[model samples]
Target: MSRIVFLEERCKGCRLCVEACPAHILRPSGRFNHQGYEIMEMDGQCTGCASCAVMCPDTAIRVFRSVKIRNTAGEGAA
Candidate 1:
């Protein structure tokens, strides 16, 4: 699965990340951070592509992609 973390205080309510997300998984949270700016959050499917993070001018977005593997015994591995 892919995960996106938005650094609320570092965000300035710019929609750059939203526009950059190819997966269209980002959206405004309708909530404000300590800086009084609306933050972004994940709202849909994510392809683990780093487009959003790369387009974030404030460096407020972090993307983590975890690789899950299954063994022949049907066990999950990290």
Candidate 2:
């Protein structure tokens, strides 16, 4: 699974990230940030595609991907 982090203070509420996300997981939050603009929030699971991060004009979004390990030894033994 992938996860996304947002720097609320740096966000300008441009909604670029929201439209850029192919998963449709991003949305504008009703609450206002310290800068007085309504920030964006993740509403669903992230695919770690970095679409939102690239579209963010303020560079406030980040995507982290999980690493998976495989059991290589067990497969050959059988």
Candidate 3:
């Protein structure tokens, strides 16, 4: 799974992330940040492709992925 964290105060609300996100996961916060910019965030449907992170001009967004592994033992297992 992947998660996105938005740095509200650092955001300039330039909409670059919104345009860059292929999944269309980023959107305006509708509220102003500490810098008075309409921050952007990845919606619940984000696929975690990191498109937004690359396009953000202010570098206020970050995408992180978590890797999971499963182990099982069976009769045929070595």
Candidate 4:
């Protein structure tokens, strides 16, 4: 499963990540951080897409994607 982490303190509440999220998992959180700006929230539905991170001007979001390896056991068996 893919996941994302947001550096809350570095976020400037620009909401660019929210708009760049294709999975619709990012939203404007009603809470404020130490900087007094509304933060963003993730719904744990990240698709490993870097769209959010690319759009974030502050580089607040980090994405981690799990690589799945498929077994090729039968490729040369026959």
The sequence of per-residue lDDT tens digits that candidate 3 reaches over residues 52-71 is: 88888778888887776666
Question: What TM-score should be assigned to candidate 3?
Answer: 0.80
Candidate 4 whole-model C-alpha lDDT, 0 to 1: 0.89
Superposed model 3: Cα runs more than 4 Å off: 70-78
Q: Mind giving the per-residue lDDT tens digits that candidate 2 earns over 17-57?
A: 99999999999889788989899999988889999999888
lDDT, candidate 1, 1-78, per-residue tens: 889899899999998999988888899999999979999999987788989999999999888997877567745655
Between candidates 1 and 4, the one scoring higher on TM-score is: 4
CA error at residue 54 for candidate 1, angstroms: 0.3
- Report backbone clashes per prediction: 0, 0, 0, 0
How much is the lDDT of residue 64 in candidate 3? 83
Ten residues in sequence with the least summed lDDT for candidate 3: 68-77
> Per-prediction TM-score, please?
0.83, 0.86, 0.80, 0.89
Estimate the overall C-alpha local distance difference test score of candidate 3. Answer: 0.82
What does candidate 4's lDDT look like per residue over 50-78, in tens digits?
Answer: 89999999999898998989998888886
Q: Roughly what TM-score does model 4 have, to 2 decimal places?
A: 0.89
Backbone clash total for model 4 is 0
Which scores better on TM-score, 2 or 4? Answer: 4
Ranking by TM-score: 4, 2, 1, 3
Highest TM-score: give the candidate number.
4
Q: What are the lDDT scores of the predictions, listed in order?
A: 0.89, 0.90, 0.82, 0.89
